[model samples]
Target: MAQVLEFRLPDLGEGLTEAEIVRWLVEVGDVVAVDQPVVEVETAKAMVDVPCPYAGVVTARFGEEGSELPVGSPLITVAVGAPASDPDSDAGTEGSGNVLVGYGTTEAPARRRRVRREQQVPVPVNGRSAAPEVVEGPVPVISPLVRRLARENGLDLRELTGSGPDGLILRADVEYALRAAASPGRPAPALTPETTVASPATASPTPAGTRVPLKGVRGAVADKLSRSRSEIPDATCWVDADATELMRARAAMNGAGGPKISLLALLARICTAALARFPELNSTVDTAAREIVRLDAVHLGFAAQTERGLVVPVVKDAHARDAESLSAEFARLTEAARTGTLTPAELTGGTFTLNNYGVFGVDGSTPIINHPEAAMLGVGRIIPKPWVHEGELAVRQVVQLSLTFDHRVCDGGTAGGFLRYVADCVEQPAVLLRTL
Candidate 1:
């Protein structure tokens, strides 16, 4: 008796309804192991490879490449066990979260997975899959950003090799090409300047031009920002603090071999301590329950801005972690955001959020609140300025802090006091030691 398995598209988070099939790793009639890479789907957040949840011969592909399939749709069918007319064989409610990428529930498959794929191979250094037959070509190797910059600067892309990681071209490469062209070094290559210009001498007229689909991370970011701004009633407050002591503490703790400690880690510690002193700042306004729910555990949300958009990946039980542990977890979560490898579990259940805009020289700006979470803190860049200490002028390092909270639940007094407490902790980080 052979068992048949049906693979359905699962929820890809942010409540996505559909996704485009970028590529299929396996084809019909291929004998695949359980949890083998079956297909790659482009969601609003990233391009993800979903594994086969059960082992069997590939029987059918319900969709084709580049097709957009709605979440909860049947993607493939494999005979893994005795075939049955009833579809209830896999309909176990306990495993609904196991749906394939871009597929959601309500269209869930009613079967328990006998096995699921576990290992995944990342995209190769060449920015393409490791499949055979791709030969070396003179294609310009520039980063996606550098490619955009080159086009904006009217530089030919074919003339430069990327100098960045994995042969990714940099903006400097394009600048070099421009400088070389302006001088007597070499004649510039013939290229089309106007994007829409057509020549009468071509062998074939360019077919109706293709438009790059705005489907993945880019599209999702636009939608989320739009929703967050329109729905959330946000109020922001900014405070300035002397961070001289914080900076000195960081300098003294720089060890040659241990995990790198950063000011953000210390700030996170301060924020968690402040949350304990004032639990109201750490509560979430649960709309469904029509009440504000204060979480017992301190799961700090680290807001990361990637090329895809803004994401807040949570560090579970942040209150329980020391400086070193928080630093390690922060590094891991940051890498996860950049590589788009964060699981749905790490992306959810944030009690309080923090965004470090100071790294980009932003002194202060109103940050949008992550939905359901009542507030978020923004850390600004530190600068040296003169300050009056005991009525004497002295140079001091000062940093700015901003807090944005939902006005529906928190009053101005409560929010202001919370920001004051955070500022106090940052100015004198020793204030956090007592809470610990």
Candidate 2:
């Protein structure tokens, strides 16, 4: 007898609570193997392929693509121990012990069966066959947020027909039902094309502008920046430095180099050295304990803007990496960020951040510090400018360096010293050689 087992969205770690379904790999009646990736989802942190622990025939899927589902919501149901549609295959009953965080099984299953796609009747519960009369199973809903909204308004989801794909109830459906119930005699207004379920307030007539839901990478960035502004007492210090020497040193190194080094890598190398000198900036504040937590290792994070949104990929043990190594790691991480392949582990745990907004062709910016990190170094475009070099006014390559530091961690003196050190390294690349 086949036993149907429900598989919910597993916790992708990094304190994530929900994920948006990007794509589904398996369909109804398709045989699945233990620990096989069944779906790809995008969370606040990164894109993750969710694997199913059970090996069996997929009976049903709960959500549509692009719909947000809270953690632990049913993703799919599998009929374990079910006979495969293919005569040559057999559905395994045991679950795979290998699983993601917040989900796992006790033992590994036997050899996986060959996956075959065929529509099959849903298996009944407790070894009972389906009755002659059509029986409705659980309500078709994916998002817990939608369920909560319906529950709060005392609305019955089963009574309302869902407008989303696969008859999945959406937040807009609940809101529309609530509005229709509130006014008994009045006819409910037609939903326009621009109507969005992002919030109940926005589920009305078409607005003048388009409403983009901030639930993915954009939402994460917004939340982090807002929290950083509200919680951190931050201060910014800026300085214009002559980067002519730095550029010349880079050209010289590349000209004679085995492997070319990137300018961002040079800046990162300088940052690690500066952090070594000023360890105060390489720490985070423990607000709960009212103590400053100085980090021993420098997990350097560099900001990279991608099609998805702004992301900061961290390089582990950055202090121990040389310029070439930093260049390679930065390149790899930037590629991952651009392609949306960065893992949750790659996107977090940074003691300091380096923002190269110069690529945006900007001269300067007061960057908001990445939360939990004490400081961020922003580099502006290096352009030709008049400077007093060797007591002569000449056109020299100049770049603006800005440091935004948490005032709770250190005073202006410490921040200013750190900024000055970075600027000195930028002005005279040889200044970094001492630490190198």
Candidate 3:
């Protein structure tokens, strides 16, 4: 007799509480090896492929793609020690002890509770079998999503047979029923606004627009920005500076360089120096403690827009790194962001942010501060503009710089001083040499 083992979704750390199933790698009765990835899930941070700890025959799976499941919820069940036709390749009596986000489980229950397929039934809630009740004496059903879908469609679960293991009612069955109801000339049951279901038949005609759900990375960005707007009393100030010298300095450095230095890296170097002179900007407000806790290290965060969305990847201990190292680190993090492989650590713990919206062709923007950070510096496009140089009007490469800061941290004088220092540095890159 094979013992059944239930595998729950492991806690993907950085305070992530839930994950939505993105894809399933295995099907029922499929042979799975220990530590093999069984499903791909999207959390707030990134997409992660979750590995199964048990090596066995996959007996059942819970949740459909795009459905969210909380941490510690059963993802799949497996029959350990099940006989495999190719035992040499498929069967294993051992288990994988691999850990994910500090979670690993290989223990099987002492006494196996054999749940026969025939005994599985839909649990009743408030006299409805589709209410996700987990008791005996009801129809055999699993996921709450299936029940919710059926209930919204007014489809009686007692009538439809399930295609999943042990007559389990899957989301597909409800979808199939809903589609059948919405067939031409077939009337859809009237649904309430709160209980409405999406379908082809009774569904209202969609206009020429796409509706993308704000989930995953996009959702996280929305939540963070909203919080920053609601809680932080942020103010922005801007100045235009002659970046001709800065641009020329970069050219000369690259001309003399073995390793190319990025313009953003140079700006980051300037930011670190400014923050060092005015450490008040590198702090977070602790609302609960009624304190403004100053941070020690400069974990510099810079904005990088990817296909996924706008993400700010942090360069750890950036204040301690040279311009060359900063350029390399930024490249690595930006590539990771584009590839969607950035870990939660790489995305968090920023003391300040540099928003180079210039890349977007925008001259200037009042960018929202990344939450928990005290300030964000915004850089605009460097374009040739008429400016005064040595008391004469001339065309110079000018860039708009804006700083958005939390008023609770410092006054306008400090902010103004910081901006002036940055502008001076850009106007003359040699000014940074004194700080260096």
Worst 10 residues of 2 by lDDT: 112-121
TM-score between candidate 3 and the true structure: 0.74
- What is the TM-score ranking, best to worst? 2, 3, 1
Q: Which parts of model 2 are misplaced by more than 4 Å?
A: 87-90, 101-207
| Model 1 TM-score (2 dp) | 0.70
TM-score for each candidate, following the candidate numbering = 0.70, 0.77, 0.74
Query: lDDT by residue for model 1 over 269-317, one digit each (tens)?
Result: 8888878877787887766778877779888998788755677789999
Question: Lowest lDDT 10-mer window, candidate 3?
Answer: 108-117
Give per-model CA RMSD.
9.7, 11.2, 12.1
Quote model 2's TM-score: 0.77
The lDDT values for all models are 0.70, 0.82, 0.81
Q: After superposition, how far is residue 389 of candidate 1 from its true place, in Å?
A: 3.0
Best candidate according to TM-score:
2
Residue ranges of candidate 1 with Cα displaced over 4 Å: 1-5, 12-14, 45-47, 62-67, 79-214, 255-257
